[model samples]
Target: MASVYKSLSKTNGSKEDGPANGVKKNKQRVLILSSRGITYRHRHLLNDLASLLPHGRKDAKLDTKSKLYQLNELAELYNCNNVFFFEARKGKDLYLWMSKAPNGPTVKMHMQNLHTMEELHFTGNCLKGSRPILSFDSKFDTEPHLRVLKELFLHIFGVPKGARKSKPFVDHVMGFTLADGKIWIRNYQINETEASKVTSADVEEGLKKKEKRDKTGGGKETEISLVEIGPRFVLTPIVIQEGSFGGPIIYENKEFVSPNQVRSEIRLKKAGRYNARAEQGIERLAKKGELGLRTSGGRAPKKDELDTAELFA
Candidate 1:
């Protein structure tokens, strides 16, 4: 596979002065592992993932004994920063461990489908490509799993459960459902169905339901009224790059406001009262000529009269 890429890169079509495959060599190195010893399916997944992140070098293929010390050694050997591990379980369930080398957080996940890959559509396009891939199996792609999958995807991609893109960067979603329990994700495109398709009566019915929800704060409050979000199709999962999930900062906030900067209403009211009383006290003193060095016109004297500079000296 490396030879193929090297050969293709060799045809410079022009200079061919430097290493043609240098670009590929610079990609991040990774090792794929699986517990219960790697099976055929694990290799398939590793190959597909390597192809997806073509820039990355596959330092080593699936590992049978995915112990912690071995993983540390592999990372050191290849200077790899990321490693993906899969643990096969009873039926078709799988536990996924994404180990970030040199002390980064390992994202752990459990997935459902494993046996259904052949029947499922595996695409040439990577998950991060603009047009994401999404396909659902009509059989196991039903209730509970489907419902749970929806919730899981929403949380992972930083998308609102109400189906809104909280941040513009995560606009695209790649997702699909499988019979055995595996999920492939892709971005979502808005449907071309026109708003004119909805009749005036439908709008009226929607408004009534919304009004009821507003008054009661029931689940129906979330019932389909606004159509900007709540896409009818499946959503995709977010892509992990550089062993880092670089999506928008949570709550659209990179850092929190300092405690001193947060001025509550109570504090503001107290401050206003203190300022007002101070001003009133000065006014009272000035009226009775008690405030030091007042002008004849009853205005406070200028700083020149106080000789603050001389006092400091």
Candidate 2:
């Protein structure tokens, strides 16, 4: 007799859908690093990149907006084995990728350097085994860089002199296949996840709730009535993660009661920046401490007192 399970659909999860059968799934971890600012163009590029990979492959696009350290974190998060750097802008923007894992590769792209020859030489030493792809836009001539690049590629790929002439020197700025047949292209646009927005109705409802509380003279009302107000700005030192990008911290007067509170507020912002400056040697000086905080302290140190040498050192 025929088995009753023979006609079952794969959707119900059966042995036929299992990997034990001849079926195999392709899993790829891809990281896209782009220097272009996020724009509508990115949407198009993202779609194209999605098409290049096999189905079921995981992909992450790290744009210029992302923190420098986040790139490394993402590499670890996705177990990325290959990285694609998309240089979409002009001028030299230094790109460096350092892998903590011994097995991973390091890739660097130095665009439009005044010292092209020297830069290429230095890059050759830094990125010995890894593939380094240099891109030049229409404004810049690739001829000079190409000359050095050709020699580098020849040394690495071991191309015969005659065969090198026939091979296309530079791939199209938009897209091209690597020596290994891996497809790579510089696409300006790609899809990005957007933050959700609250509607006007939501704001109206919240205002109505506040009106009700005002009428009820809610004992719980903690609102402060200010007679005088002035423009105020808060400066908070932020720590930037090694592989992540860092930016300014702007807060309205309503946000903090004191400078000390800024640290706690920042913790709420992103756990990564919490206690950043303190770890780097910045200490908050209270008024009393500022007067005679140190053994030799007299008055608060001037702005120059903050030594940034440690950062560069």
Candidate 3:
């Protein structure tokens, strides 16, 4: 009937190469913009990312590495709703994420700055939300650079100084470090602490260790217990449907080399250079007749027959 044909046409138009469930099957599309570190390993990583999400696909032809301004334009052109931007600069790494959905904008960003292992102790511990605290091991009571890094972190986390008294300010702890000429970023969760009464032998020993005399001239001592809380994780660079933080990497250090890939480029280049030297060596040896042993080691002895007289005797 005419009605059946109309129904079939509509279904076919909305059909996707997926399951035949009752829901509409439009493929999930994501756009990745990167160039500096693109390699076979990265491609495999991107493919892995796509596989994590159900029905996700990556458009390999369209690349938007340095072209951030045209994000929206190319996204619409390619009909991709999710996009990720990655970059590296001077041992620092940056990441940015944006969505081209109809409702509203979704953006997330992460950065890793360079730092020495000894300089990580200054941040101390986290005292807020159910996230862990990520602190450096170095004490920077006088280090000016540490101060600057702390200030930069204020843009992404922490509540205003004035409003903290009214509403408790507690959130995740974000930090960075520089290693292998690249900056690495990490996120942590700081959880609340609940006080508990302790009376164990170990607790008593700890109490003795932390005993403090009263300043009031009273012959009394006080002991305090400390509890360490917080869980930490290294945030990888691969773009995901949604990560711990909802931001993308818009900026990164230049000297940064992403993970899961080897630094064999230099070796490959050196191999090319050595190729010419090898050819030159071959020519030199040929001229000297070293490799041309057939000519120098004496024309390989003429094809003389065996002593037939000796064999007959």
Candidate 4:
């Protein structure tokens, strides 16, 4: 097993480098994890990893765009047995990969969301079998998040479930950025008694107080952050071009496709051509790149799916 290193290329390109043999000291295998549909975010992680690697180190870099066959080939080419897996989402796919790669070095890269360190620790413990390590960078306040995260780590790794006793195995390396742009790394240990005080009750009471203030007209609604609104998911526009009928469509599966489809059932009415036009309009508004068509029983449409008389009216 060799040490994994970041991809370094000034042109910002992805290409395999080094010899074809199965033994090399300068080459290491790494996996970049991210939301399946979002390649741009994956690129950001690549760039960040490149920047973090020690300068002037002779190392091989493999991006996720590289096919699995290619990665295996590179592994064999470099005699590489070690793997580094990076996680950027809360999704379960990363855990699946980690479970499959039990013999490799797995690292989880996390974004600083609102819950911050607490979420990170939860994820780390949930994927404890992965032997996970974490890296986070965000504009959010770190002190509170760090404290919460540290407590979670202690709770998961040191304190046994349903027990009042704490273990001494908790240790961590923390890095913080200062107001002057300097970064500092510090060693720390967790104090369980203090950490346990930060429970769900404390958070619920705080929220209750906020609600009471809002009801009494003590605070403005606009002050609340949009993150408190609801659930969030990434939406990507898919474009499909064919002849002169190029248009956009929404891809619900997050898989990329080409050319949009106009539902034939909607196109069957006496005035149903307008349905295609309306779909085109929606595609334009949504900036969709790919379209999906729903058909029934290998037939275009039946009387139930569309009403011819109503369409004409």
Relative to the true structure, how large is the alpha-carbon lDDT of every model?
0.43, 0.33, 0.40, 0.29
Candidate 2 lands at a TM-score of: 0.23
Give the Å error, residue 59, model 2: 5.3
Worst 10 residues of 1 by lDDT: 226-235
Backbone clash numbers for all candidates listed: 14, 14, 37, 11
lDDT by residue for model 4 over 1-313, one digit each (tens)? 1222333452233333233333543322233233243334343433433222211111333345324234334434544333223333323211111111223222121222122222223211121111112223342236543333333222222223212122223323223322222222222221122222343433534654455335445333222211121111111212211111112321111342211222333446646778788988876644432221333222343344358776776
Per-residue CA lDDT of model 2 for 1-313, tens digit only, reads 2445645544456564464446543223445555554333333433343333222123444565444445556656656533444434322232322222213323233221112222222111111112223332332223432233232222222322222122323211221223211112221111111123333333434544455346545354332211111111111111111221222312122322443365577767676565565554445444445756655554755534357964455
Q: Candidate 3 on 149-239: residue-level lDDT in tens?
A: 3332332232322221222444345455544332244543332222233344224345433342122222233233222221222332233
Arrange candidates by lDDT, highest first: which order? 1, 3, 2, 4
Question: Model 4 clash tally?
Answer: 11
Error of 2 at 203 (Å): 62
Query: How would you order the candidates by TM-score, starting with the best?
Result: 1, 3, 2, 4
CA displacement after TM-score superposition, residue 113 of candidate 4 (Å): 12
How close to the true structure is residue 91 of candidate 3, measured as C-alpha lDDT?
Answer: 26
Ranked by TM-score, the better of candidates 2 and 4 is 2
Q: Which stretches of candidate 4 lie over 4 Å from their true place?
A: 1-40, 44-67, 76-191, 195-313
Per-residue lDDT of model 1, residues 1-313, tens digit only: 9988887777653236345544532223455556664566655765554433323345543445434446656766766666566656542445565555655344444442343234344221122312222334454336543444443333223322222112223223344544223354432332221322544433535645456346545442322222121112211221222223222222121232322344466699889999999999978877766444555546564467459796786
Give the C-alpha lDDT of model 4: 0.29
Task: Tell me how many residue pairs clash in candidate 1.
Answer: 14
Task: For each candidate, give its TM-score against the true structure.
Answer: 0.33, 0.23, 0.31, 0.23
Q: Any runs in candidate 2 off by more than 4 Å, and if so which?
A: 1-28, 33-36, 55-69, 87-104, 109-313
- List the lowest-lDDT window of 10 residues for candidate 4: 225-234
